[model samples]
Target: MRRVPDVRPPALRPAAVLPGPAPRRGPVTVALAGAEFGWGSSGKLSAVLSALRERARLPLRFVGLASGLGRPLLAEHSVEHWYDLPDAAADRRAAVGRIVRSHGVRAAVVVLDGAIATALQAAGVPTVFVDSLPFLWTEGDRAALPLDATVYCAQQCVGLPPECEGILASVASLRWVEAVIGTPPAGSTGTPGTPGTRTWRKALVSLGGLGAPRLPDRTAYPRVVVPAVLDALAEHGVQEAHLAGNLPAGLLGGLVERPPAGLRVTAGPLPHSAFLSELTRCDVLLASPGLTTLLEAGRLGVPTVCLPPQNLSQIFNGRFHSRAVGVDVRVVWPENVFREEEALGLRAKGEDHALELIYGGIGRVAARADGTPGAAGLRAAVLAAVRRAAGGADWGALTAAVGTGGAAQVAEALLAIAGPTPARGA
Candidate 1:
């Protein structure tokens, strides 16, 4: 394995520096600006915020910029303040500035939202940007924010721009998950039914939040694919499966009401801790190529099969991370999946050309899983991949490459930028 590059910024150059043991003297407020894209970003932000609150041992306040899809989750996590980002740049900046001033926010952690980071930095609040997909980073993205620090939560370093100060750490989701699930026992190789044992019995299925409101209804994919996938798993001797994601409760209920025979299926949205704990118990993970889910499954050494992703970033993340870890995650592209009405609805959302291009591209890729041949091929491929992963993929080496203590390391960096805690009253 190649040596993990040292990408720490000069300011954070102290080797093995962890969050200081000293607790803050008084109340401190730090804003976490998370992207409105999916559960992955907000879920991660929530985990890190929780860690900072616990480790700092201070009366902390969390403020959030909630995306339409992310609002409920943010509310669920109890973010003290929530604001909907305005349409105009000036309006957005003004809104963020107002919040920072009103809350007296000392620092901010911007998760994948560069524009918000720029606004907070301009307001003179210390800021750190968490770049979950380093591969997606661009010079333009950095120029817009130019944050004080950039932390990459990835397995391998994909060299960032020379001008950008960067820190590479293990996937934050994995660190958070392990913190909750506890580490797997030493020398515990493979999940259940590795070679000598019976065929794999448990599977966890999840497609993270759709993230796009104008696209097809949430039930579209589940209505068509869940039965088939469950049936296939059951035929392969898989006895039980758990389905979890940001899907509506009604859709989950629809699936549970009519599950395939011989295969028990339970579905719901799980809290971060519960979700990770459950991942550790599953034999295989079937999920969208969200970086958080992928890394958590990889960390726990669970076999993973990635479904056709809704966007290009997910596709790239799935391919890049899978190869980096030597895990042959099969990507099953479903053909003819999007209905005409769904396509039109997405186009009508006012970003016509871009949406058309994206939808067209995804449609082409998804078309690959159109027939019995495609479906059977995917099922067989997933089974083989699961067997290989369960038998043992160099998970130790992968985790070592990523390193650990991500949340604390990031919290330390943020605190450093925030400067010394204020002195308490005499």
Candidate 2:
């Protein structure tokens, strides 16, 4: 008997051996945000989002909130919608609640934006909070953070000074991670320098933390640091360089005003990948010591000189860089400007008190463009540090000390909590 093969396309592709929760009916939407103060938070979010894209089980859509200075930074990523941070503090909760509900956000990933993270959690969305500056927090900042987040990923630092004691431990679901940085593409690694013979062909100077809201004048750091770095790069035989950051519009002309003979200097902000690409190709990197940039450059084996810290975290970052490299690869603010010890000491009082000294000192130095002793001292230090980096010493220790697998670790945590709730479809 010709039993017409009982084929209904093999029972419509045989039923699942075990029934699963109907395989997420639609793309899962996730909320993303970074602290508005600087690019550090956004950079961290970029790395994590990149990692999540790789690891996510279902198709994903991203919506952003309150990523102010960072909104443009994530331009190339896949964020489908963006909402400015609520203009009024009073509206924060309601605004965020509306966003979560409207977007159908199954989960959220917030980098250092505690207020938003807390708000999303209150709206009944699980959140994975990345705290890149766990060591920068104190009692004063406790109220701003959601320590009991579903997953609190605190970047493990070189040391968790006495001042930051318990800040990390207090997180209800704290997970310590290595540097959460994105992997650069192939051929981005730096060349190993020869002590006497190497000539830096290209130097990339990255200045982050430039748009910190509290500082009305964004030019202070760049005004003092740019020319000094350009000159130093020229002295070290660098033929060309690029300065990347959120520099003020009119500042570009001044940054390139006086490049050393035969040295071509260009200055402007770069997208995250673009900046990292430049970092990997350059012979040396001079940057405002933001941890994310330092970690990115370090992973590429790029010779990095911490251009004196721009804010609280940077001070510690510069010190950590030096401690890890076992060399002071930092160009510091002159002691007359403000001692690192003194600023750090003030943290016991509160970050604002410390920031007062830092901001005022930088402002004072920036005002001293006439080559006053303090300003000249700063210029000399930057020159010396970049010069040292050009000599081809091992500067990868900092990255090695703080491993670079953090982005994946963070992604894993986020995915775990991102599971659909009983109320929502799986």
Candidate 3:
């Protein structure tokens, strides 16, 4: 049986002595970058990677192991081959190393931290872990996650979790792609809307891509939660309600079947742009806490009624968003919201009432994922740093954060940074 390297290393004792400065590479070379992008989730991630790659001139060869969920969006950017390897992490690392050598790749970029990332790092590959997505980096001992260097969305989001103070990369995600990407559909100005100023008549309920790939409603969290919202809306006399998400209609058939007469539920897949646009149109958003949707809704100035799922990661996301910014809160008993099926059933009808209370207290806590001044500023820095290190002509500072990644620039950056490393125990 094949074994995967324990990427999350065991606890280490504290030390004071510092090692002498090790040899520094003349430049950075990126061989490949992997992100599990698909239609519903990680679409922004792949796009961000592409843009970063282009700016850095790193050549990227994507390995579409899981499925072509993000293939359509990827196809639009560049027609790269969909490479796949064995499922095991060790095997993946081996395969990736082979590909890197064959393609003459030096370092690899893993868009988000996960099995693939850990595996690549285990293979002794020079890696850059990009904390672009909201991966509760707030809690983990990031140093344990294998990587030569790290980049995060913002310094606020990085650092050692409370339990351990380990070495983490100076790279901040927010700083990495600010100027290179586009902003959310909502304008970037003032503090993000809080729950106090805006009054929402009804709370929109969804679990986000309910029937889709990353998150499925096998346990029917949506079924339990949406019905509660429907009941709440009816009681408040909020006749018209919009249900936006990808929850399967069949799973939610019962809730919709008797949906209190006048409420309108529109459920299907909407691209990220359209999704943000719809958020602007809606007043209240009641849903599970997913990074993309939650962040966008917050950015759009929409009050969020978050029902965090059972997963520790989900709970962390909900708690962080709530505490970090002021939003309404429903303290579901037992840390795990997924376990509270009974609560879901009882509160399903009262969700709208909760939303109303939440709307009454407008709060501000969110940043635009793209094109905001903050985001744009970060992108320009990365581009400038890469060009200076590469000795490339100073392309003036990047002003706007474009939504798409530029692969050609990535290719150039990677080659500039890459150099020969001796095989194990040279």
In candidate 2 the C-alpha lDDT for residue 177 amounts to 76
Q: Which sections of candidate 2 miss by over 4 Å?
A: 1-24, 187-197, 368-375, 421-426
How many clashing pairs does model 1 include? 3
User: In candidate 3, how many clashes are counted?
Assistant: 60
lDDT of 3 by residue, 319-401 (tens): 55554443234333232212433422323233223322222211110122321223233233322322222221111111111
- For all candidates in order, the CA lDDT equals 0.58, 0.77, 0.41
Question: Residue-wise lDDT of candidate 2 within 189-238, one digit each (tens)?
Answer: 55433455356798888888878768757888777777777766776778
- Candidate RMSDs in order: 7.0, 10.3, 16.2
lDDT comparison, 1 vs 2, better candidate: 2
Order of candidate numbers by TM-score, starting with the best: 2, 1, 3
- Model 2 lDDT-worst window of ten: 5-14
Model 1 scores a C-alpha lDDT of: 0.58
Estimate, for each residue in 99-205, the C-alpha lDDT of model 1 and write its tens digit. 88998888888766768877887787877666665544333344443434333223234323332222222222211111111223344443322233336789999
